[model samples]
Target chain A: MIDTAVLKQKLGDLDEDGVQALLDEFAAGTPSAEETQQVVEACQQGMEIVGENFEAGTYFVGDLMYAAQILTAALEQLKPLMSAGGGQAAKGTVVLGTVAGDIHDIGKNIFKALLEAAGFSVIDIGIDQAPSAFVETAKTNGAEIVALSGVLTLSIASMKETIEALAAAGLRDKVKVMIGGNAVSAETCEFIGADYWSKNAAAAVKQGLTYVS
Target chain B: MSEEKLKIREDLLAGRVPKRVFMQLRFTLEAACGLAGVDLVKAHFDPKTKLQAYRKVCETFYSDSFPIENVRWPEVYAPLGAKNWVMSSTGAMQHPEIESMLIEDYDEYIEDAFGTIMKKILPRIYPKLDPALPGAPLSFAKAYQRQQATGGEEVGAQIALSEEFDYAPGFFVGLFCEAPFDFLSDQLRGFRNITLDVRRIPEKVEAAVNASLPLMQRQAIPRNPIPGFTVFIPLHLAPYLRPADFERFYRPTFDKLIREINKAGMAAFLFAEEDWTRYADALAALPENQVIQFENGDVQKIKEVVGGKQIIGGFFDPLITLTRSKEACIDEVKRLLDIGMPGGKFFFAFNRHVLDIASIDVSKLVAVLDYVHEHAVY
Candidate 1:
């Protein structure tokens, strides 16, 4: 007999400790459908706190990384009990990676986390990924969206080549290709033939979901 | 005149020699001399020994010829070692053994070493250097201070140049403040936080901007001989930011910096390091004649916003250019030039530094440069 109102109140405050205690109470017994929704909502609240801290400069890469881990842990616990189809419906799948010759993954990882939280299935291909590898992964996973990540100025061309290869393979139209990284631009996106250009993780997730939907 | 010297001189005047070639030649020569067990100090005194070492390096690494032509070379620019030394010393000051040896205490020592090294090296390598060449003037502020300390008259700081050098000058400026937004999240926060902050904590953000403006304004001061442009690289506004955030957090700061830069009699080079497509209206509000070197923005949209007002540079992906074949390289360069190089004041290079790529194809890159020189119009 968990009080859903109290759980939602704790979640809204983004009290991680309070949310964790509420989660523990739910884990001890079967929580109703509304109670499970409260857990999901609590996770969202935690995300908001992380976002707030990040925006205010009190949080950093380490904090964002830890928040992602926290969300993942709580999500894993709630995944089984989540209404079989009641959880937000995923828009589509996106296969993302940092292009070859670039080993930066912080941006890509954050994008993946944001996407997952937004209820999109993400297959992160990691860094230093070849153009062919992106095409192969997209084809294998039936991913509707292919996202390329790059941080170095040098890797923009590689990202373009990947997009060109995707087009050459005649798979371009089937999948919406998005490019994000420090070095990419919309003109470069159009020049490279990518479908979308996003500056960071949150926008990438938003645009990715929109494209799939 | 020596054939090699004549060739290099011609290339420099034509701006055909890529900067990387000098770096590669220096690196290869150093390595070969080391491998041959040549004593650097001994060789410095003996012309014969130095020439012999050079010949060996040329023969083994740079082909068996006396001079290499149109070959791509590595660019090995020297960093501000004194700054690095200071930073490292400051980092180490936290330790028990060296806590007392603060960076300020080591300033004189660092200055002396830096000045001595510059004085010893500059005249030897760049005797006939021009101070007015773009990117030719190096910042040796520490070295100059050391010269002053060592009873050397103010002869002015020496400018190092070589016939084989190509210089592209750029800089990074902080876009926002450190008080309201932490530096780490400021670097990586997405647009969501950007938007929410404006709606929720506008006053705090404004205070941070106000506090940060003076520091950013100071960086706009141009101190070097060859007037290099100052480019402010902003990382705060990105995916998590929206048009409203830009208006609130970014616009006023930029307006202040632009005004300061203009007042200082310097050009403002704005390097937007994020996708600013959604906030084009805010970007367009920036002052005119300032160059906008976009890192990861929507190019067409950027062009629409600032194309007429500012000199736009970048958007080429350096990675593909490094790895692709010469044909592909030529095509990409030509295309970018057609779009980005149309208006005068438009300079081109890899959208960013080519940190990771196969070595730059010097010939291919040179070909693009030739095309741009021939075709670029205002």
Candidate 2:
């Protein structure tokens, strides 16, 4: 049996091969749904170390990036096992997109990876989406949380428009809204009617984890 | 008076203490148009309207000089049918994360940078540049000539108008260049692909960046340097890398560009566009006097590390000007100046470019600029 603790450390250290080797070994042995879930939890906790180190200035975007990719691959190796065993149901669905008028997505993509690792089905609508598109996507996906990301100033206006669109659709009351990007802040979050905001990716995933927990 | 306004910060660039903190500012084309109440699409296409709008915005915004926001050359991008750089509905030109080069082609690219870009990348983004289509080259050549000529005429007219308004572009680099790693991610390998490549094919990424540096520097740095200007390099990659990765992949090339430009007696104005608190020591290690305009970081830490070694500018957040009340806006300006002004080489500028008038309070912006112009003295 692979020690999830050692796997966590290896992932945190950004040992891509080591992390994969451990995950592959666990998968090669017909792992149980609970075991798969436990390993997934370990990866999530490992990403926490990555995020903490990023905040502490020891790691950076590149490290977080590599860790995200590695964690994603690790999760993929375990997904089949989890499925055969009817793994834990996803926590909830989160609809994510870069808000209209802004196309910057580095932060958005990173958050998506971590969110998926943390076990949420995220439907990422691509960039330059209109409020109508966001409204339609959120409604069709039956999203529990809508995450809007934009780095430009005009995106704030677009964010407000999108929230108003959701409100107009009568879906605003049901789904919590989160805005992430440099353009979002406490003041703008309030102005835009979002439930939470994050400027950086690591903190964003942390916020997402808190939302469901 | 206009000439002095244009060269307001030339003294600081020349290694002398100035009477006041020189405020460095740039309003992206759409932002300037928004401030002037001009339609973006119209101004984007019409050179005459854009020049007028830029002048009006600069005057009203109380900038000491005309901003090098951008040069609108429709003839260049329109005919090329550039997929990455396109006009957005929100009144700005946004570059999509598109890569023309495939990851497997790194060896071929490293072998011949220019040939690969010209032969492989340009044609893919701009199908009009495909050699297989006969006369495509001729068609593009004609467009290039017309674009250059029109660009020169428009810029001349804009400068003349700014001078008439009594504030002209102080020092502006007409050419745009990129740091090596930035070029790799932005131009060839898309961000997602490059992020994976950095870890997967680490050696190949290093080799490609190293191979491309000389070509980029030679093309960017001038033989006869402009006294007050340099090739503008908007840094996009270094801030994302950790210090070790940055030093390994990005720093050498970044240092070379700065060193080559400075050796020719001109300073390279680098728009460092993210938190660079990690790379302070690395920047400090480089030859000093490069214009490093930061976007966000601890101002006091930046002042401590790269203070007088380089001409430090930017720390004030433009978001504050957009979101805060007038009193709060001025207070933030005061805070930035209190930390940045004591150092002889420091100048004031917002960390991010002024993107548009939609989010920003025009009154607060004016008040903030007026306060900086008056109170941020050495």
Candidate 3:
């Protein structure tokens, strides 16, 4: 039996090789749905550790990035096994992208990984997406939330434009708007009429869960 | 050089002030030229027009507060098909397009790294350039040589311009060297891709950055010690890196680079681009007299940590400066001085400049700088 506590510890410690070694062991065994869910829960717990360490300055963005990679690899190994038996249902659907005129997607990608790990289906619209494209996608996909990310000051204006476009399409009230990036703040979120803003990836996923629950 | 300018330089080199606090005020050419009512597009292309406009702008705002001058260079505008700046509908000014990406695919980057960049990336960035055409490498070499020649001329011209107006010329070579990760992220792989690669294929990322260092050393490490000799290294991706990972990927090359610059008898102006507050303990261990210009970090905390050793250049918030009234701006300056100036190593500058021409209040900037110079003393 794989000691899941050890796996969680290695994942949080950002020991990529150790996590891989543990996952390999777990995969080689006749994995049941209960074991798979336990592994996924360990990954989430590991992410919480990564987030706490990040806040405490013991870890940095690169470390969070590495942690995300570990979780992604773990999921790839276990996702199929879980699907063959049973797995946690996705909590929500999020439509995410970097706002128009900004090509930076680091924060957005990190948030995507965290949200996915937290059991949310994400439709990433890619970078420099227009407001109309966002509105249309949200309307068509029946997305519960739209997350706009940008790292430039000019993106503040783009966020507002995206919100107005959603409102124009009569989809504003139907979907919550969340914003995250280096340039985003609570003040900017309020000004842009967004429902939420997070300074980091973990908080983004948590806030996203709150909207769904 | 004026006595005041010489004194400022001495104090800066010693990592301590003599008596009164020193201020290094900077301005974007866009802000200066806009103040002077010159068409930026026209001025950028014509050397005489550019200098004449700069001269007029300098005459208008040449004070103790306006000390540093970024010498104007005759820029060659991109052709119609590949223009990076688009003209406004009214034809009053040009706005820069979003920064274009150079590398389309990261999988091909290792191969492209070994291949001719002119054929691989340059043509994709600048549509006017053709990969099929011969002599691209020669043209690139000639352009580089021309830029070096013009850079020397620009320094001379700025010195004359400064003397003509009785302000010391603060001409320095902007030797931009990125940490290994940033070089890949900024130049070849986008941040998203590189972040993914950091976990998926860490060794490849290391190898790619290691391969690029030799070229960076040759290009970015200043060879000649001209007047106002300074190597301004703006560090990105450091704040984002874990300490061990940073030690592995960036610190070795960066330490060697600094040693090489110090051996050349040049001052290194290190710009801590993002929030490096977390790395204060490690950064404080570096050799002294380097000005680590903080763009977004706690002034008081950084002061307590690294203030004794290195020169702290800035902590004033640019957002406050841009949004606040003149009185509030001056108050902000006072607040910064209260926190940063007492130790005698602080210089007053905005965390960033108000690059939007219309948003720049020159009078407010002048007031804040003047207030710093008059009231901030050791």
Global lDDT scores for all candidate models: 0.51, 0.79, 0.69
The DockQ leader among the candidates is 2
lDDT of 1 at B4: 49
lDDT of 3 at B46: 53
For model 3, the docking class works out as incorrect
Model 3 / residue B240 / CA error / Å: 1.8
Candidate 2 on B36-88: residue-level lDDT in tens? 88887887667778777777776777666666467655557777777777766
Give the DockQ of candidate 2. Answer: 0.59
Q: What is the lDDT of residue B25 in candidate 3?
A: 50
Give the TM-score comparing model 3 with the true structure, all chains together. Answer: 0.75
Can you write out model 2's per-residue Cα lDDT over A151-204, one digit (the tens) per residue?
Answer: 787798889999999999999998889898876779888777888888767877
The CAPRI quality class of candidate 2 comes to: medium
The residue ranges of model 2 lying beyond 4 angstroms of the native Cα positions read A30-38, B1-3, B72-75
Chain A of candidate 1: what's the TM-score? 0.79
Q: Which candidate wins on lDDT?
A: 2
